[model samples]
Target: MSSIKSPRQIAESLTELWSPRVVAEVDDAYIKVAKVQGSLAWHSHEGEDELFFILKGRLRIEMDDGAVELGEGEMFVVPKGVRHNPVAESECQLMLIERKTTQHTGNVVTEKTRSLSDQLRPV
Candidate 1:
């Protein structure tokens, strides 16, 4: 079993975008904390869904269909194989929930995909 997590505390420790720090994990899923700004690449998980919960600022999810804006205390789920890009106009803190094996950049394996093994840490 794992311990409880305090995302606020975990988020406080993060200082950059695309650099997520694991705050907790359950089974094959991981809860990560990140600070973000600017635009992220368009990508999609092959077989897993990803959830984004905004804790401190605004986040925008851009999809081929449309754009979804999330504010503090808001969240949205990006379903499997659905291409989307996340963007933030200002610094924001958020939690990302997805399978541990899920690629950070989904189908787009660019330099931006921070190696999952390198950024994960036990809560």
Candidate 2:
């Protein structure tokens, strides 16, 4: 099953804030999109690097040392073992690229956390 896919369009179809939906896979990585607002718990993936690509709106990734702000058409990568929290003052659409074995929310678990199975659900 292969076809043209729009990350933005798939991101727009997402309704659950912070719940990322898996859209595709490339080797050991999973490409996911999420519609989010507010903040996700501070966490770190010990063995995986996380990539965030903004599709719409703005995002600020708060880290222990500092924070980075990203707007539409921007992207950032949180290296493995760096604690960070993603915050969006308003609704935001973004895509994520992470290892298939990466845990959602990493070492921290919260109500907003979505498991791999949940993320794999169709949009």
Candidate 3:
């Protein structure tokens, strides 16, 4: 059986970096934490929507239709198959939630799309 993990524990295990670290999983979805700076690649998940919550600093999401800016405590959802890019001029802490099988960078497959394999804990 999987053991329960608290948010504090997950935070402690995560290292501050531009890439995301899988922190928790619940059924089909996984929670990923990341410290982002600069721009993320443009891409879209073919089969799942993605949710991003800004824990600290600011984030800007650019899409083909428009752009949305999120501040600390703000959240947004990118619908499945919609092309989007995330940017942070300064360091930003964020929580990403999506299907467990979802790729971090969709089909882009760039070096920046590295995954935090097996890091997710059940809580």
Top lDDT: which candidate number? 2
After superposition on all CA atoms, how large is the RMSD of candidate 1?
1.7
Scored by lDDT, model 1 comes in at 0.86
Cα lDDT tens digits for candidate 1, 28-118: 8988888888887999998999999998999999999999999999999999999999999998899999898888888797766788876
Query: For model 2, how does the per-residue alpha-carbon lDDT over 38-74 read when each residue is reduced to its tens digit?
Result: 9999999999999999999999999999999999999
Candidate 3 ranges with C-alpha deviation above 4 Å: 1-16, 116-123
lDDT of each: 0.86, 0.96, 0.80
Question: Ten-residue segment with the worst summed lDDT in candidate 3?
Answer: 114-123
Q: How well is each residue in 1-123 modelled by candidate 3, as lDDT tens digits?
A: 876755434544466555677776778897888778899899999999999998888999999999999998899999999999999998788888999878888979775777645344332
Assess every candidate by TM-score: 0.91, 0.98, 0.84
Candidate 1 vs 2: which has more TM-score: 2
Rank order (by TM-score, best first): 2, 1, 3
C-alpha-based local distance difference test score of model 3: 0.80
